[model samples]
Target chain A: MYWEKDIETIPREKLEALQLARLKESVAKASSSVFYGDLFRKIGLDPNDITTLEDVRKIPFTTKDDLRDHWPYGFLAVPKDDLVRMHSSSGTTGRATVIFHTLNDINEWTNIVARSMYMTGMRRSDVFQNIMTYGLFTGGLGFHYGAEKVGALIIPAGSGNSKRQIQLMQDFGTTAIHIIPSYALHLSSVFEEMGVDPKSDTQLAIAFLGAEPHSEKTREKIEQFYGLKAYNSYGLSEMDGPGVAFECPYQNGMHVWEDNFILEVVDPDTLEPVADGDGGELVMTTLLREGMPILRYRTKDLTRIIPGPCECGRTHRRIERIKGRTDDMLILKGVNIFPIQIEKKLMDIPGVGTNFLIVLEREGFNDLMIVKVEVQKEFFSGDLKQLEGLRRRIVEDLKSDILITPKVELVEPGTLPKSEGKAVRVIDNREE
Target chain B: MIAYQLSIFAEDKPGRLAKVTGILKKGKINLRAITISTSDTFGVINVLVDDPEGARSILEEAGLTVSMKEVIAVVIEDRPGGLDRLVQLLLENGINVGNAYGFVLESRKKAVFVVDVGDQLEKTQRVLKEASLETLDAKALSAIEPFHYMNY
Candidate 1:
């Protein structure tokens, strides 16, 4: 019933033993790269010295800047001819972190993603429609290969074209779909516009929602709208994307595949491991990747390990849904807030549309946060008092939720910018 | 008395008004009367048009938030006291005009005052009738040719 059952349900001690051996092999592979090789030799560290998982801390943490400083091929442990494919970040901030995968790495990644899909109850008979972008973004190809490996008829529906996506769902008896959570909400409106009730009209039984951090409420909203169970899939391009962790049928927390990744939750400031079940920055060490194995790469994603064994009979430990990226945290008026918190609060309020923008600006020396929310079309009926009341209520609600009174601006529906890729929720124009 | 008016929510920025008018012009929908209500950062434009449903759909398709609202249109004298009298009559009763605009049909002789009383449509029409105001229905409102004199 399980994919790679022996490894997936291995005893705790056996799993640790497997992880340590793989971790040492991965460290050796990572040390072959110029970046890690130079750093390890300079720091007087040897890959052979890492006898225990705790010894992983002895190796310096690899930062995104280090990757950027090394640029194009500094992290490649194999020869250029051995590399099969590469995926990259958007690189809006600086140099993009491009991860290369060898044929073996690709095979391993595909297997993990296939295992993840199977865990979510997708079978070979299922026709999977992947609605995430396919280019340099790992979400598309990662899920693409996995669904193919699962022997499902894959529709490489690479995002955006809501009408075409709906048409595909109807035309191809699409049983499963992989989409971002926000887009799933947006697509529901399109389905409404097309006069098709997704619940009754299509054969969508399973939805794999990821590529962005979304709350349980968002997942519940998508489930209610689309009439399908949406399992959360988590990964970043630094590690092979979209299948690093996935929710099983239980749908509680995503089981981090311990056989492939050595996961750690660390205090972002001190770089010390946080106690189990406590929130901190998630650090991952690649155990099976050969092309570009990274040791203790800080994902910048903040989440906690779910302390108990999954009821799904999988022995791999689970991690809570990502709270927010450590970099995406906004500090205003001495209060630290994540955009997801604002999204959760705004989404709960009636008449607030699915899209919003949190704009941070500086007026003189003080920081100002202005939340521009889209008022639903039905609610934008020029009722001056009612509109004012909604604005006031939003301001009050946000103030109570985030502990900072923000200027709430209600715009017409669909006024905020909609991104086909990952939605840019925050725009900070404050001068540092 | 189901006169339709296209109420559009707009941001108060340069060229925004031009953008709305440009869309209507391109769509071949004629605007009969238009009024803008502004706040600090945004405004709402209520336009009386010959084809309100057509205009609303086109505007909405063009990414503008347009809502078709039913309003009351009344013919009144174009003299200075014409609007004052109508406002006085509505106020004498408890009816509040949520939005109002006027266009002169013939200077000093006749004009049309379009008023939006929100959900209190029946009460406002009753008050207007009691005051002996000549209100135009949707047919008459759409048939109005501004500044073209026609003997009654």
Candidate 2:
């Protein structure tokens, strides 16, 4: 019944041995890259030195800054001709982190993604509709290839156009969809606007939600709205997106593929591994990647390992859904949001003032981020509808840039609080 | 043009209109006619005043968004068909009235309609003149003493 039954159900002892073998190969492959080669030589390290899983700790943690330091080709383990594709972060904050894949790497990623979909109970008979953005972003193509691999009827419906998306679902009788949890929540309103209850109107049975951290309450809300079982999927571009881990039918926690990568939870400050079942930073290493192999890469995502074996019978360890980031990055509605990114968007608009605040609150089970900006005195002289048009334009621009629609509240100039030192741009009221 | 109207950007909140009228009162600007066009959150207040420029500058100085717009003052009989006749003529001529307000100048014989024809101010005046309708410009509008009823 499993996609790779033997590999998936391998005993703990056998799994560890497989991981160790693949780990050594990955280290050797990574050493061929300029950045890792220099680091390995400086430490006088050898791939053969890592005989057991514990020896992986000897490798220094690779941070986002290191990725930035060696942009474009510094992490290339293979020749340029061997590379088949690449995916990258939006780089709204700084330099975008990019990941390259060889043809084999793509096939492996596709297989893992397919396995993930299969674990969620998606079948070849199902029509899978993928709603993530394609090109440069991994979520789109990652799920696209995986669903295709499962022999499902694939509809590569990119993000937005809510009406058309609904039409396609109704016309094709789509049985499955892959989308961000927040967008799924947002689409419920569109369904309501069209007088269609997703629960009774379409043939949706399963939803794969990822690309952002969401609470269990949000998952339940999305499931209730869409009338489908919502599965949590997790991945990062560095390790290949959306298939690093997935929820099985049991839905207790996400099963991280042990055959592909070594997962670790470590204290962010100490750089020491935390005991299993304790929350800390997620660090990962690629075992099967060919184009580029990352060792001990700190994901900066905070999650804990669910200490027990999953009921799904897969030997893969399960990681709890991500809690928060170690950095100031806010994942609002499944899109990475930085206060500075909002600042940049506001500064680009002519009538917007310098002082702005991002207020995040929870409306029902979904998170709502409202960007309150001051309108210049001169701009306030327009007709009431003109001001409204300006507000809508700002909202549209910000949504296009960040992929999450934010409510733009235009306030009078000098109304928002000013600061002398570093500005406090984000006021999170979600906890309240 | 004999009549000028001040269009002030206003938010739909209690005391917002008071704030605008308060500023005009402080400036001693007499309000001849006023109409508020509102949506959900914000609105526009179109006001015919004795001194349009003075009202605009003072309202702007008080931090209210204010602009001066030209409008035509039409004098019609204060009877049942007076407004209908004027509106029908504008409709037939394809002239859109962007903003309009009216005030009765006498008990039954006279009323003044302040119409902001937007960019069609000249064409609207021409249409009114050809139709033998009496129209007033800024000078005649500012000189009107409406409260004191006189025989037409």
Candidate 3:
């Protein structure tokens, strides 16, 4: 059932041959791609000359902004009719970056995901519950397809509604759960509320958690509560989502699908590839993508690449868990909320007086984001004691609604500063 | 009948009360009775709120780092030594009070004492009544207005 042995075991020679073969094919494909053809011509390099993996670095790197500049379908190597699936990122504004996948691309992605699940000790008899959001986000469907690809029954559970998810775990003998680690902790608390010890629950052997950066402390908590080993799944919307690399039973670093993905750890500022085992920004080149092929896409995720063979016996190069994103996507509590979440939370609530300033401050050890909200005149008419009581009430309500604890200060209506551009919703004082 | 009392563990800090109260305020929950007893590193804030479940969830959501323990709430007269009489009665009955605090009810002529004991709650209630002391149901404390008396 195994594929080629040399490519999977003897890494150096196999990588060299794979690179030469893929480079020749990619160069020919690049010569035909409109965007890459102009890019190669502008750079004064003949794509045919780049035959080996060593020479592949001669090609330029692609970035998020580059994809944004091209917009809808500029990066696609194939026509719209051939594109079978489209996924998007949850960008700051409504406009999201789109990715297209062909039938071949889908099959390749499914293979890698299936390989990842199998490595994590998943079996065909296992019931996989994918708890990530589906929609434009790749977390849900990506995991679901991978589980089904391995002949496992999949429950497209999505995220939130912890009450229902726990109940489903009882109804269906869910053996594997895929969701963010923080949400798993939230589920642990819900498990306690239902009077069922999570540790003694229906067959949850392994959990695949991703979509945000997490600490080892958090991982220990999730493992202890669920009574199952927690594996970290790493990927970005720029890449092919959460199946990019995954922790096998060994729990070393994640085994990158090196046969399909050409990875380089580069210094962000220098743009030069760093030495192996050193931390740097990850830049990837898809060897087999058809709908949208990137030469060298800068993922901007900070982590080191371990070139050594993993204990799981996979020769695939591995990357350590992601520490943080290059951009300012802050994950607070268990929610993947942006600074915009604050504005949305404030605007959604009525009778919460205006002139608010969202200040991010670190209190003791905990990072706190306090909202200085104005107290309306109607709120004052209530009992002074009750008004003070109401103040606490509003803070509690906002915390539950947004899933982030925000300290509410009742300020005067005209105190906060007005903004011209995108409202400076976040006043970040936490040290950069 | 019965009175519900809750004991919450808290780390010692300047604004700890403000934080706990802040969570209660946000939940739109009302505390009927509250007492804070301090030790070296941590303090226990005993509270009787209108909705125990709602209050517990709010406190946990706010990340106060607290735990809940049940205590007995007994009704005593608003007069001085009213609690002393009960304490003497409990002592004669071989009952020990680990912690004790009381909150006055303005609408009634009674004050409720939240007492932590090593003995059984039912046995303690019967012992207090045998000594002619009135025992209140756990819900009685939730109906009283929470007076914000700052210790600072």
- Candidate 3 ranges beyond 4 A from true positions: A1-7, A91-95, A331-432, B1-152
lDDT of 1 at A164: 99
C-alpha TM-scores of all predictions: 0.60, 0.74, 0.62
Return the lDDT, model 1, position B41.
61
Candidate 3 on A1-432: residue-level lDDT in tens? 223344556566777687678767766665666778788889988976786687878888888777877788778887789889988766334335688888988888887788788778887899999888877677887888889888898988888798999888889989899977657867777788889876686788889988767777778888988899999878766677767888878887887877777888899889888987999888888888888887788887889998777776677888898866665456553234455556666666665665577786645324577877654534332122333554577677667655567777655344468654765456767443
**Model 3 Cα displacement at A303 (Å)?**
0.5
Q: What is the model-wide C-alpha lDDT for candidate 2?
A: 0.85
- lDDT by residue (B1-152, candidate 3, tens digit) is 55555445444567778988888898898887777765433355778777777787777666543445566777777687877888888888788777677777632466778786744677897887776676655455454544421111
**Docking category for candidate 1?**
acceptable
Q: Which one wins on lDDT?
A: 2
DockQ of each: 0.27, 0.23, 0.02
| TM-score of model 1 (CA atoms) | 0.60
Candidate 1, residue A428: lDDT: 77
> CA shift at A108, candidate 3, in angstroms?
0.8
Residue-pair clash count for candidate 3:
11
**A1-432 in candidate 2: lDDT tens per residue?**
599999999999999999999999999999999999999999999988998889999899998789979997999999999998988866433456788999999999999999999988888999999988877888999999999999999999988898999999999999999988767877888899999989899999999998877779878888888889999989988999889999999888899999999999999889788887999999999999999899999989999999877787899999998888887778765456667677877788887866888889878546888887777666755356667887888898888777678888776566578944677568888762
Best by TM-score: 2
How would you encode candidate 1's per-residue C-alpha lDDT over A123-147 as one tens digit per residue?
Answer: 8999999998787778889999999
